[model samples]
Target: MASSGSAEVERDLTRDIRLEVSSSNRSSCQVCKEKIEKDSIRVAHPSRSSNVSIMKYVHPSCYLSSCVHFENSKCKSKCRLSKHEIGKHELRLTMALTSCEGKLKDQVFFHPPHASTLVRQLLDAAGGTEHTFDQLCVSLPQDAKAWARDALSGVDLTGRRAPTVEPEVKPRAPKKKRAAEDDEAESAAKKPRAKKAKASSEYFVEDGDPFCDGDQNDGDAELVD
Candidate 1:
């Protein structure tokens, strides 16, 4: 009975978030919907429902982008490093500080650069120099693991929030202006040129010869009564 109880406890412990290398390529990442290749690093979030445990795996970067980082979260308090009030709508990094029951008891907000520094301090306290980033992430507290990975990796969280929709600036229509110009051009093209009337003494002539009056010759040759 003691051995059986120990095995059950071990199984229960495995149903938690894990950072590890993939053993097979069969599992697809929940965030990007891509196959996790064998030997690649992956993040797993495990959940139990109706006595069955299910594990969802994602790539490290995908997991950081999808879960760990935020852009539009309002700051509720001062930054941990600067001790200045974070503006209500200002962009900030959020790290949840959870209780032993894994219930979130509080949150720590920081500027992006300051968040990185805090993560490094935590890592140094944990003797993180000897371990790779993945190993250090695994050693962090459960609540800190995701954000720690994000901070260390320098993931940009500025664009992850729900996008603000700006009012569309409809382009000004040029049809009215273009139509006015076209009307002016058409009027100019169709306008008649006024010619000064010539005196009767100026007979119509051929080849600029005033004496060679073709109209007078044709009229004089007409039959008379």
Candidate 2:
């Protein structure tokens, strides 16, 4: 009975569900407070207590570190996972990201840990704008963008829906007249115009010329002589 119990314990220890991302923004990582930035991956692990399951999120690097904690007197060293172990988890995550459409479909079936999270990060980088996959691919980290491109290589994104960006139309400023036209108008206004001379008939007889007075005086002297 003890041997059977030990075997059962071993089986339970080996059993692990694949990690994924939260579908909504309702939850945060218990360990890191979800300090993970936008366009970054996350991992959600399942824990069961009294037959009820609860999920908690962490970074992939954090999760791996938690699995390899080692304390010793010699060198204070840390253990690392074998290539086979790493490959196994990597394949799981790759499958999860590729098939789940950037979200976890079910809790019972596992694919990769944090697979959906990585996809979600890539989607956020590409969403809500007119950016194509190629345009977005260059903005991300080398590993992340490469993984995203590979995951999407076999899938058709023609029908994929992204967030819509409302088009903004700014009012244009009123156009100003050309400098030549303005200068012409200003110069025309500044120049003085010539006035026409008044005719002799328009003048009043308030004063007479001296030559007309001399002619009158000579006529009066001839009359007196």
Candidate 3:
């Protein structure tokens, strides 16, 4: 059982709308029509990396089979839904519900941030919305607490709450120096310094180019020799 404080924190942190409906539509997943919604569930998967889907709810049965991180023969239950979302999809799976006056507003899906926008668009094509973040985080799912525990690797859920922000403090302005003295200092600093050393005035005596055999000597000195 979660404490009242942690419970509220968990709710706020994971607030999202979740729904369970019995659709006689019997529609198999459009991605794979092999299974029917009557016996299967439909869910959203992010089309690309790092972008979450909004209102793109996935089906329960479909999720178990088609998850990218589908494991064989170990854990095959609906309880592992959050695990699939966190582990398989770089996107998160949040069950945030919207509300007006702290009451039911609507139900929607939240994909992980890493998933592409197109995934959400695809979901919207079927069933989705464009609700804002504040509109979200109202009705979070219970799954988030457990999944956060497992995925977050056991960070304490105790005492987690909405952060109380403090008022901002502005910095003080810099002091102005005395004008006459500052000007004198500035002018003195800007004066150029004397040269440290002059380059050597000596120049090397030239020899005939040795690159060509035609002129192998220094200006025909070898020819004279």
Candidate 4:
């Protein structure tokens, strides 16, 4: 029975976690809250909720130190600070809140650096003495107690929260509208030019007309001759 239980735990760990080279730099680390550059090694934790699966990523060092229960996760909704989607598979930290009866209430997600600032705010609101970082870590599940302690060893809880960056979305003209404008331009270019009308007082001088090349006086002389 003991061996069976151990094997089950190992299987769970393998199914939930993995390490791979990042294919792109679009994802940020949940631990250090920095971009995991392309082609770099990163840890992935698959989290599931309401039938949706989100892949959370982090740096290897951050994963080693963080509590297993508080493992880095992906943002499930729009970020409060950035007012934008943190994007699928982006790394984020999860803070779970429970009721007085120890019932799970809600969970809030934030960028790794932002999580630190929030902890500071919570402490300040509670008179700064009610809770400490160590105390908070102690409250978490002890699945990775030693690692959790190491994770917070040199972390700065008072450090400034890094700003959330909004993704750039360039507006594109509608295809129908663009096509209509192009058609209008093409039609205008293809229109035939209107021929100019001659004035009522004007007449064409034929090639051999007597007055075609000479003054009126010369034409009169030629007529007399």
Candidate 5:
């Protein structure tokens, strides 16, 4: 009888826990082998093979792909609801409620810096002038609440969290305002001779040609060039 009860308890403890968006860059998805970024949604499943409980993580979309049967076969065969379906349904309910708060805050989603989805969702949902949010969380199904608790509690098989992805910053070339100013100054310095001072009488006697022989020769040479 004790052995049977222990087996039942083990079965009960081995279910998938919760869906969460990672708030840390420290871990990668077990399914896609890609870094799960901050604010990106993910899911957790407890491994049943070991005595010590271990959690495996994957992106939300990868849930179906990662798990061979996310929904239990027995449940499907019996046409009964499974813990997986229930957990996901509750998660979506929470997401919808969070989206409501996100809408209120004028954001597509409510995300807090360095905070997990459960924490961010709870805070965003509860931050308003209503106490209904608290009640809503309280009203969550036990399985759903378990998910939230496990995620927020930060329990994992490995003690380490994912490493942060530091943003790459490229060095920019310096703009040369001095070079532009220098160019302008050089252009100004090279200004056309003041219209030859209208052939100043004080400078020289009036010649038949407007330009002197030397000037005319220079002009012809320029035209040839």
Candidate 6:
């Protein structure tokens, strides 16, 4: 009856706590992407960009690790962010160029990926059949991750994609430092130009051949005669 039930209830509570403690044990190293069982550590929220796939699980440590690169910088380098709000607007500038030079000149970077490991998660999330990456891009928009998912659904195979770029064809070579120095010197030699003159260019006459005028020729002949 109620006599020993109190003790039994306490025992049941103890067992439940122990089981929960054991069940939640996971020892995955988020940074290195390794799993450890006994020495498992709990990672808090990580610094993963929204531009990634859901399948790409980073330990809280791993995700937070890369945020320094992603955060807005006052004088940032070229990346997700930059000095003058480079990445502030967050636009993905993509261009297709077959030649390596063209791609390089355009600063375009392209990489492929693994099918089974990298893409399946993205495809599964997007609800696209495994062959509609480009078509789905319209609705999905700019996330690298969404694009990756679309690509996964579209491609038959996957692995780390290689980077192949068309080199940019420079209409002109980058101005050499030495040549720039010369230009600087020339500019320094000349005084800074005054502000735009109020007078129209009409003040400055064009080069004209005085001899071309019939009146000048006739006057010369008469003088010679």
Best by lDDT: 1
TM-score against truth, every candidate: 0.32, 0.23, 0.21, 0.26, 0.26, 0.22
TM-score of 1: 0.32
Local accuracy of candidate 1 as per-residue lDDT tens digits, 112-210: 545565444444433424534465456444555565466556676564431222345899877988999999999999999899987688446467575
Evaluate all candidate structures by whole-model CA lDDT and list the values in order.
0.58, 0.41, 0.36, 0.55, 0.43, 0.34
lDDT by residue (tens digit), candidate 3, 115-146: 22323333333343433221222233443334
Model 4, 151-220: lDDT tens digits are 3343553543322333467998679988999999999999998999876986779776876864445534
RMSD each, Å: 15.5, 19.8, 21.9, 17.0, 21.8, 23.0
Q: In model 6, where do residues sit more than 4 Å from their true spots? A: 1-113, 116-118, 121-151, 154-165, 171-225
How are the candidates ranked when ordered by TM-score, highest leading?
A: 1, 4, 5, 2, 6, 3
The global Cα lDDT (0 to 1) of model 1 is 0.58
By TM-score, who's the top model here?
Answer: 1
Residue-level lDDT of model 6, residues 98-149, one tens digit each, is 2224221122111222222222333333243533444323433354445444
Q: What's the C-alpha lDDT at position 189 in model 4?
A: 95
lDDT of 1 at 142: 57
Higher-scoring candidate on lDDT, 1 or 3: 1
Residue 96 displacement (Å), model 5: 26
Cα lDDT of candidate 3 equals 0.36
